[model samples]
Target: MRYCIERLDGQHCLFVDGRKELLIYLKQASSETITDIRKVYRNGVSDSVLEIYLPYRKQ
Candidate 1:
């Protein structure tokens, strides 16, 4: 899986090539709680290439 930070529609987003569950977990990190978030699932053939988009906040 791969991870990167991006901005979509003027909002910070976390692009992760993995599960959507992981994205949710990341948004709720202990360092900074992210209350406003949106989840998006992209194309995936398997666990290795799954793409998930989640709202991200810099901590």
Candidate 2:
């Protein structure tokens, strides 16, 4: 799957699979500030998909 970044709000951003609105949001950030952030693991549909983790998110 292809991944991309999007601005969800004034202070929030998202990194998601291209073409889908299902995304991950980050507070106090924007698309322009994306470079300042670090990306690690991601959760996706399969083992080969990016293993992104929503650590700060409340389960």
Candidate 3:
């Protein structure tokens, strides 16, 4: 599975492919600002496992 980070309406968002529990856990555990988590489905398949809204982080 892969993940992508994007910006929508000025809010940072995350999208990750489904079926990977460890990946989800790792992301959540490593990030403190992640919130509004939800799943997305397409054609009844869980194509996107996580849609997390977070504040922008400065690197």
Candidate rank order under TM-score: 3, 1, 2
Give the per-residue lDDT digits (tens) of candidate 1, residues 1-59: 44433334326655555445555556566423333333334553223221233334234
| Candidate 2 per-residue C-alpha lDDT over 34-53 given as tens digits, one digit per residue, 9 for 90 to 100 | 42222324563323222352
For 1-59, candidate 3 gives per-residue lDDT tens digits of: 43443334328766667437535544455444443344555544333323332332221
Candidate 2: lDDT over CA atoms? 0.36
Model 2: colliding residue pairs: 41-51, 41-52, 42-51, 42-52, 43-52
Please give the distance, in angstroms, between residue 28's alpha carbon in candidate 2 and its true position after superposition. Answer: 22
Candidate 3 lDDT trough over 10 residues, lowest sum: 50-59
TM-score of each: 0.25, 0.19, 0.38
Q: What are the candidates' C-alpha RMSDs?
A: 8.6, 11.3, 7.5
Which of 2 and 3 is the better model by lDDT?
3
lDDT of 1: 0.42
What is the TM-score (0 to 1) of candidate 3?
0.38
Q: Tell me which residue pairs clash in candidate 1.
A: none
Error of 2 at 56 (Å): 29
The lDDT of each candidate is 0.42, 0.36, 0.44
